[model samples]
Target: MRGPRTQTERDDTTVEIVYAAVTGVLLAGAAFALVMSPVLFLGDVPITTLANLWRAAKITAVVVFAARICWTLRRFGRR
Candidate 1:
């Protein structure tokens, strides 16, 4: 068996995990959109009140998450 990981190794692993997670999320979202686009239009689902609210919430979450990630990257780059 090998010894425990060093600080640098742990940091690298953490960075890799975060990058993979973000990439996976983006790719999954894209794939989902591509696959669901046709089905969404096929249905006559009206853009009613609750539907708009849910969509707004989803958009807000995505925007906030993106902003936070960008801010963190900028902060790190300044160091």
Candidate 2:
């Protein structure tokens, strides 16, 4: 059976919603970066540096996000 919800649970739900909104922004930024990674045939300009930077940031964001979720779960489980 489902347990009664506490203030902490409500807070976590709010946090998760904020996290979801942030995720949309992150995905949009990543997609933009991927598209901009390659250049048109200028015959001189190399691939952009922002791609690598954005890629690294994306990976880090995912890891930290998973950690945040775990933290939220722990908080919810507590009395």
> What's each prediction's TM-score?
0.48, 0.40
Worst 10 residues of 2 by lDDT: 38-47
Alpha carbon lDDT at 33, candidate 1: 60
Give the lDDT of residue 70 in candidate 1. 65
Report each candidate's C-alpha RMSD, comma-separated, in the order given.
Answer: 10.0, 6.9
Query: Clashes in model 1: which pairs?
Result: none
Alpha-carbon runs more than 4 Å astray in model 2? 1-48
Model 1 off-target regions past 4 Å?
39-79
Q: At residue 36, give the lDDT of candidate 2.
A: 46
lDDT of 2 by residue, 1-76 (tens): 9789899878877886676557655665665555544543334453465556556667765665565556655655
Q: lDDT by residue for model 1 over 10-62, one digit each (tens)?
A: 89667855865585457546654654465466676456744664565566556
- Scored by TM-score, the top model is 1
